[model samples]
Target: MLHLRAICPAERTDAVLAALKAEPGVTHVVLLRGAAVDPVGDVVEADVAREATDQVVASLCDLGVDRDGGVTLEQIDTALSDAADRAEEAAPGDGADAVVWEELLARTGEESRLNATFLSFLTIACLLTAVAVVTDSPVTLVGAMVVGPEFGPLAAISVGLVLRRWDLVRRAALALAAGFPVAMLITAVGTWLGSRTGLFDPDLALAGHELDFVFEVGPFSLIVALLAGAAGMLSMTSAKSAALVGVFISVTTVPAAGYAAVAAVLGQWDICLQSIAQLAVNLVGVVVAAALVLALRNRRGQVRDLGRPLGNG
Candidate 1:
């Protein structure tokens, strides 16, 4: 179940309650008249079934309740009420298949931030990949894959593109554009310093084909990336976060950057260019596949919601 709290102007209070009462998947309605101080409005709260969240939120947004007031939605750990059960049963689809647009906006926006933590994780993942490159360590390469933080921005790009949110698309693009180069540069420098100090082998790097899949741009690479992107987006929409880690391991963005850095340090220009190409291919595949998935879902949802668009909600 989802808990929704909305601060609505007193003038809109009756309409807000009307919307909630109209939805069969909403229950436990509570109204606190004149409870809102910040927005100086009435407070309206309700328990909504997960599958009906998109429609309910859209109805409120259409009322302009979010303009003069605000809406906050969250998950309820436990709701031991028959009304909640009836609401969930009345909802059209399975809860696990529903996509909450507002929740996704917040999640993807946070992921697309090019902050210190994002930079550090990308750089660290690439550094680990560089080490894996020198040692030809498959386990360490997998570790680097797991440590990469590019998933969020990639998801943001997919969601943003589908929703036609240009600002979000540009923001996520900036994060990737700014993040990869920085990580690669740092990894390259680290590799160079390590080689100079006898901590890494430039010679061994020449035979580093074990991790070459990262730079081996081909049809199969794009296929894997496309598959990973679809799965990753589905995981986010359905709130099955555990699946995202697997998607991370499937994509080769961080590993490619790591390989590019090591190859640059070893003076292997061909491999470096190929690695960058592979990285671009993988990112493109992920973005395209995820956008397609979201677009399809949105279109279907429009029909299911009786002309109300789901993505824009």
Candidate 2:
């Protein structure tokens, strides 16, 4: 369920109330009038079901509430009201079952653009990976992977596919295609310079390393990426950004990129190709897994909508 706070002039309160009353899944309407010192209007507070939030918000907007004063709706993440609990008791599935493709797309935010934070994250990931390779530490390599912020855009691409947002899809694809190569190139140059300074010795290259954990692509890596992608999507949709740290560690993208750079610096062409392949496999696995999760969740949402006459459509 969602809680909405709408501020409008007292005179227009009737229109706003009328609009809210007409909308489905809107209940517990409370009006607090003449609260503002500037006396712009009254404030209307209400609880709305998650399924009906979009329509209710749209209805409020149509009533010119936004222009006259303003309407703000925030999702209530706490315990539900008695009425909502009763409704949920009557319903089989939780609100998450009603997460439609559109809702997911909205949660995805602006995928058509790359923000500074994302770019900075990529840069840091690349830099960290270079440092890890030069130091020949698997721990540092994993640290670099966990620090990378490329997963958001990757998840955005999957959300785009499930929602059929071609703009999102194209932007995500472009970001991935462009971002990885650029990062790899930068890491490669950094690795080369590190080699020249005797910071990274050719003997420590991962190419002929016997450790099964260091340079091999296996089922374990695929599983890790799949899990990481799922967790990433959950974190993104819930807006719990802190979980991304664990996700970065769960995937091998940064480690593989680092390995590729290290191989390039040592002039090990075969190992470089193998590392690149590992990175590609992990990327594909994460995206595909995320897409499948979104698709299934969307299908469940459709089913729930069919069962309820909430006028959400």
Candidate 3:
């Protein structure tokens, strides 16, 4: 279940209440008049089912209260009243059980873009990954994966496709297409400097090292990417953000890019190409899997919305 908060003038309270009461899954409504001090007005709270949240929000939006007033929805963990219990019962089971494409898209729409702080982290992570690849340190590679911010754009792309939001798709693609090339160029310069300073030796490569797992692309990599993509989407839609960290570690985009940078420094075109190929394979697998999942989820939602009487019409 979800709790919706709305603030509007006391005069407008009746209209807003009527609209909220008419919503499909709204189980409880509370009105507190002229309660706030700063920009004081009335507060209307509604308890609604999770599956019906999107429609309820849409209805409120159509009423123009979202602009004239403020509206917010938060997931409710426990219910203290009968209305709340009904709302809970109306909720879809275990938000993680299946993807809800429209809900996912709506949730993603709320995500903020990569700001300066995030970009700075990405820079530091890329540099560390580059250094790790040159030194062949598995520990540093993992650290880089933990620090990288590339997953946001990738997730945005998947959500964009599901929502059919071309602007989002273009923005995400631009971020990914531009981000890696810039990171690679910067890493290449760093590697060249390190080679001259004896901190890195181009003659020494980790191709024979047991930890050299960057270039071996196979079915396992595809499976990992697919699973990671699904998990990532689930994390985005649900409240389980901690799981996204694990998803990041499972994917190989950052490590592969780091490997490619090191291969470029060593002047090993073959290894560089191989690393690039591995990254490509993982990326393609994740995007394709995410798109398919979204498509299936959207189809199911449409059927459910139509209320087709559960059997042959």
Candidate 4:
């Protein structure tokens, strides 16, 4: 279940209440008239089923509650009310399958920014992968995968394409374009430093290692990427996010890029090209798969919203 709180303008309070009362998924509606001070409006609150969160939120936004005042949503860990159970049963879809696009757009906007922190994390993740490659350690590679922050922008790009948000698509594309090269360059420098310090041996890097599959770009790689991307989008939109870590582990984007950087610094042209291909394959596969999943869910959400009224101008 989800709890929603809205500060509505005096004139829109009645419309907000009517919208909530009309939705079968909403219950326990509370209206405190003239309770808002800063926003100078009424305080309205309601409990809604998770499956119906998108519709209810869309309804509130349609009434211009968000523009005139504010709307806040929080998950309810424990709602012991029988009314909450009844509401959930009345909602059309399963809660776990619900897609709240507004929340997703907000989250991806924050995550996909091309800021110092994002660049730093990308650099660090690639560096870790470089170390893993030189040492031929699967554990280190997995650690690098866990630390990589590239998935945010990739997912954002997919969502942007589905929603036709050109700004978001451009922002995410710019972040990836700038961030990856910078990260790879830093990783190359680290590789040179490590080799100079006797920490990384070029012979060990060139020799076949147990983790060689990280460098292989093939149909299998694309299949793995597609699966990971689907799982990733599901984890993002659904209530359970625990599966996200598995998606991170299943992808080879960071490791492949790291290998490419290290191979380039060591003057191994063949390995460099192969690693680059691996990185490209994984990235393209994920983007295509995620876009499809989001597009399908978006269609369903739109179908559900067909008769909804537009927000006040």
Candidate 5:
């Protein structure tokens, strides 16, 4: 179930209440007249079935409650009322199977921003991967994968593509285009500096390392990338946080960037190229597969791009 709160302008309150009452997925409706101070409106609240969030939200937006007023949706952990149960039953689909698009849009938008935290996390993941390569630490390599923030932007790009929001696609693309290079460049510099300081041995790149798999680009790598992308997107749409971590651990995107940076620092041009290829393959594979998943998920109105586009065209 979901808790919905809409602060409606005095004139829109009746229309908002009518819409809420008309939704079979909605229950526990309450109206607090002139309750809003900042927005200066009446507060209308309701409990809605999770699976019907999109429908209920759309109804409110159509009544202009979202613009002239404010609408907020929140997850409901425990709705013990009988009406809540009826609302859930009245909903057309399972909650877990539903895609709350507004939540996803907001999430991906924030994630796609090329901000300090995103840069720091990516750089740190790469540095971790570099260390894992030098030391052949499987644990560190896995840790690097988990720490990577790249998936967020990648998911953003996929979502944007599916919705045909070119501005979203461009913003997300900016993050990827800028973030990876910045991370790789910093990791390369750090590796070189560490070598000079005796923190790492430059010759380690030439040595046989089990972590070399991080740099190997093969057909299997693409297959794994595709599978990871699908699983990642499914998890995101389903709002399963735990499943997302598994996706992170399954991909080598972060480790590949780290391997490339370390190889470049060691002047192992061939290995650097190989790692770069691996990185590219993984990224392309994930995005392509994720976009496909989103396109298919949009079938039967499971997901809809209803809001105004950020793009001009």
Candidate 6:
């Protein structure tokens, strides 16, 4: 279930109430007339079935509630009312299977932003991967992959492609294009610093590291990339946080970047080129696969919506 809070203009309060009453999946409607001081409107609140979120939200938007007022939805983790159960039963489809597109758009938009935290995660992940390569440990490599925030922009890019939101695509592309280079630069500097200590020897590490096989760009790597991308997209659409961690390990995104950084620092141009190629392949694989998955999901949603009566789903 979800809790919806809306600020509706005084004149539109009746329309808002009518819309809520019309939705079979909506219940426990609470209205406070002229109670929104900042917006100078009526405060309307309701509990809605999760499956009906998209439609309910769309209806509110159509009423222009978002233009002059505000509409916000928050998940109701625990709805103790028997009315909530009745509302859930009235809604079509399972709640978990529903996709709230506006919510996704808002979330991906935030995730795609290249902020300080994003940069820090990417840089730290790359540094960890570099350490994994030097230490020849697969565990550390997986750690690095899990810590990487590159998936945010990748998911954003996929969403943009599916929705044909070129602005979103451009923003995500810019984030990825800028973020990787910065992370690689950090990785390189970190490697150089580590080399200053007797504990690090790039040449020796390169000769026997397990990651050499990981960096090898080949058909198998592409296969893994495709699978990882598909899984990652599914995880995002389903809101499966645990599944995302597996995706982190499945794709070679951060590991490839880390390997390239270490190779560059060690002046192994050939290895660096291979790792770069590996990175490119993985990125393309994940992005393209995710886009396809989202496109298919969108089509299915459209078909289902078409099958339903107007204003009912």
**Model 6 — which ten-residue stretch has the worst lDDT?**
304-313
lDDT of 2 by residue, 1-313 (tens): 6778888888889988998777656777898888745537898998876666656666776677766776666767775478766544543444554453334554454543465666666767877876766565667667777778777678878877876667677777777777777777887887778778877676765533332253577888788788888877766555365887888787878677767876787887777788887788788888988888777666433522211111111
Stretches off by above 4 angstroms in model 2 are 5-44, 49-92, 96-103, 207-215, 235-244, 300-313
Model 6, position 104: C-alpha lDDT score? 71
Ranking by TM-score: 5, 4, 1, 6, 3, 2
RMSD of candidate 2 to the truth, in angstroms, is 6.1
Q: lDDT of all predictions, in order shown?
A: 0.88, 0.69, 0.71, 0.87, 0.87, 0.84
Q: How well is each residue in 183-243 modelled by candidate 1, as lDDT tens digits?
A: 9999999999999999967887759467878898999999999999999989998868789
The total of clashing pairs for model 2 equals 2
* CA displacement after TM-score superposition, residue 8 of candidate 6 (Å): 1.0
Candidate 5: stretches off by over 4 Å: 300-305, 309-313
Candidate 6 per-residue lDDT, tens place, 131-152, comes to: 8888888999889999998888
lDDT winner between candidates 3 and 6: 6
- Candidate 3 per-residue C-alpha lDDT over 1-313 given as tens digits, one digit per residue, 9 for 90 to 100: 6788888777778888888777656777888988845556788898877666766666666676666777777767777887766655666554444343344554553332544655566666778877777677878878888988777777767767766676666766776677777777777788888888888666775547644677788888889989988877667666677998998788888778877887887788888898899889888777777666666566533322211111111
CA lDDT, candidate 6, residue 181 = 97
lDDT, model 1, position 42: 97
Error of 2 at 8 (Å): 8.0
- Residue 268 accuracy (lDDT) in model 1: 96
- List TM-scores for all candidates, in order: 0.92, 0.73, 0.82, 0.94, 0.95, 0.92
Q: Flag the better candidate by lDDT, 3 or 5.
A: 5
Which pairs of residues clash in candidate 5, taking residues 3 or more apart in a chain or in different chains?
none
> What's the residue-level lDDT of 240 in candidate 6?
68
On TM-score, the leading prediction is: 5
**Residue 191 lDDT, candidate 2, scale 0-100:** 76
**Alpha-carbon error at 124 in model 5, in Å?**
0.6
Q: Model 1, which residues run further than 4 Å from truth?
A: 300-313
